[model samples]
Target chain A: MEENKKTCLHDKHVALGALMSPFGGFDMPIQYEGIIEEHNAVRNACGIFDVSHMGEVFISGPQADAYVNYIFTNDILSVEPGQCLYGMMLHEHGGTVDDLLVYKRNSNDYLLVINASNIDKDVAWIMKNAEGYDVVIDHRSDELGEIAVQGPLAEEIVQKVLGLSLSHLSFYTFGEFTIYGDKPAIISRTGYTGEDGFEIYTDHESTRRLWDELLAAGAKPCGLGCRDTLRFEVGLPLYGDELDDDITPVESGLSMFVKVDKPEFIGREAIIKQKEEGPKKKVVGLEILDRAIARHGAEVLDADDNVIGTVTTGYRGISVDKSIAMALIDARFAARDTQLKVRVRRKVFPAVVIAKKFYKKSYKK
Target chain B: MSKIYYAETHEYIRVEGNEGYVGITDYAQKALGNVVYVDMPEVGDEFEAGDDFGAIESVKAASDLICPASGEVVEVNDALVDNPRLINEDAMKNWIIKISISDEAELDDLMDLEAYEKYLESNPH
Candidate 1:
């Protein structure tokens, strides 16, 4: 078997006594102090995450504008330079290739940020589709390191610790600046956590320096364990859980991100058809009545004990303090207040269908 | 003082004559992190050695609690239903259940405190 890859901060995490685990082909930190403590830090105060494992691909050429719009589900033409749009890349059959953020640099330049687990497959898909377009595909997944500083106090912490002023950047917008003696860095007012934050992308050396400064400034160092809980609470979909190669954006309840109104794009017809006729299965939020957690792959059953669906992700919610889960079940049973049951281990617990957004998001905009 | 025996799976049985208090080891709780819930078998439930009695859930995942020996459950720790973090605070003090040993011979199969500590050193999680 091939050895797992390590991020630039692997040694730092180990030095802090982090519980290391394999995630998305990288040996990453699962927790520092504890998952619950780190989770609360992001929600209440400030937290820093080493997100260097995320992939970065640059597309440039005269045809970049049209090329990106054709490949991505969102309408990149609507956004101006220095702005970002969140959407998915879909197969012709409407299943998601990967959900990504497209940063519009200019008319002929754009940056695509993708999931770490789907780096190779996504780059290959992008390259294969570039055959007919006059665009340059620059796969730069290995050259950049990224970190996210998130929470309500992120703006102040970024300013005081990193010596960067983000007053000009709004939500989903980015700007280029020189840090550490003219080293170019990109700071974006974006984050997966449902809080006002910034994602900084820079070289490995600068990334390490920024991380140390933030930690010294009292920003909680978070790991993937809390990252999952934070994103799940806000209804943000993870790649392998809420979406995959076989799950369409519509089926995953992410229709808002898929611009089906666009005249030409891959999977447009399939998305339109699914919207018109409705999808066979829909992802819905569930609140398990009992204390037992309905983990991923647990069976969702009906009143008659008939199998209905499967849990995509679940947790004893740190913020909400409920046994909440997101499950993909038959569209017939997707209505709010619909009663369901989740079979966990030797016992079955009653559950009720709820809105996917278990906790109200606190976005700045 | 009662004798404590350890199973290979990390469960501990504190024996007092033929009755024993069963719970997970301190090492097991440390590995599991913040315990959110503990699934305990009801009184009078019978299990064979190596049978899965219940589960212990953390915020991230769930793990099964294996039976250390053949026994019938005499009592369950009801306090765990409302507050499961007791295990994290003190695993030895927060016994999950009280089981009446069906066969004392099964106790011989488990490891003593000294052997269990040695086993942990060799097989780290």
Candidate 2:
């Protein structure tokens, strides 16, 4: 493959002594201080991450709500102004095309944040299915960028740096905020990691300034390597891993987003059918019995040596003190405490099924 | 006296007076990126030099530890369980295992510090 692309903060990453690597068609920092150190920084204090590579699509026009509800698996009509809803964009066959969060800035304009690698395909899918809809879906990936400020003390640091008060910012809410005098930013109380955080969307040139400002305010710069580890520990689903084109939100235990009770939506009938008849397979969490890791594509086998499923994402849980993984297994064996074996390289290590979440999300009251 | 030998799988053993210390070289640890876990051998395990002894797991991958010399394990550094980083800190000082070398002649087949350093440069992981 060609070398991965670079983000707006590519030069800043190198100057901060980051280890560079390729991710999602971008040459990104795998770590700044190191994976463990950065991971700990975000868990304990606050960390600033250059997530500019995340794609943003602007969907507008009078028929925005109709277009969004038809494409995503959620009740787009229910999202209030200045609110965001998390859901999956499903294919006609009911499998996940991409998992995204659509922010309804108002009745007419909305923003969709999607996984970087799926941006092109997602736009293509939306446009292809947009027949007869009086709406415009514009790809704004290059026009704007994003940064995530996350951790326990993140809110205080954010208020201090941005000169704004977050006194009553409810979870999953967003607002138009000003930073650096004239630069405009959309601040959303959202994050992939199960922590207190905000995603700041701003113009491309202004993103680097915000990154430097946040860093100078004492927020440690983190990278995707620790970001993956952090999100894995929190048991978040990744697009290419715990989810994919062949995986449906219902089978992945995300039926909460696929509301069949809504008037009507894409993948609704298929999801309801699966709900009634039961899914063929389910995504499950695996806790390794030992230190041996179960990596992506590792086989999951039963006691009879029958192949049941494959590991999608695996990592060393710094807090849990053992290897953890998420695997999509036969529904019969998806229950917690089910005994299984993970084929790690040449060895078949024992594992056990557990709750869907590897770690609990401690949402602030 | 001192003698050195290596397993074809890239582990080194330094033998001295019926005893030897075992560890992967600096090159091996560097190749394994961010060591996370080191499964240590027990205090008393008998094994041939080329047998599968333990494992070293990094965030990116895992490699089996091969006995570099024929010996009975006398002691194992259990500290590496939580802090496998001891491997990267000082692979030689923080020996993974102490073994009672069963044979002295096996030392003649291994590389010395100079040869092993050259061996690492000549080959890449």
Reference-based lDDT, each prediction:
0.93, 0.83
Evaluated on CA atoms against the true complex, candidate 1 attains a DockQ of 0.87
**For model 1, how does the per-residue alpha-carbon lDDT over A16-126 read when each residue is reduced to its tens digit?**
999999998999999999999999999999999999999999999989988899999999998899999999999999999999999998887999999999999999999
Docking class of 1: high
Every prediction: chain A TM-score: 0.99, 0.97
DockQ of each: 0.87, 0.34
lDDT of 2 by residue, A30-143 (tens): 876667778788888999888888999989998888888888887778778988889999876688999999898889788999999998899898888877888888898887
> Proportion of native contacts in model 2?
0.29
Per-candidate TM equals 0.98, 0.87
Interface root mean square deviation per prediction? 0.7, 2.4
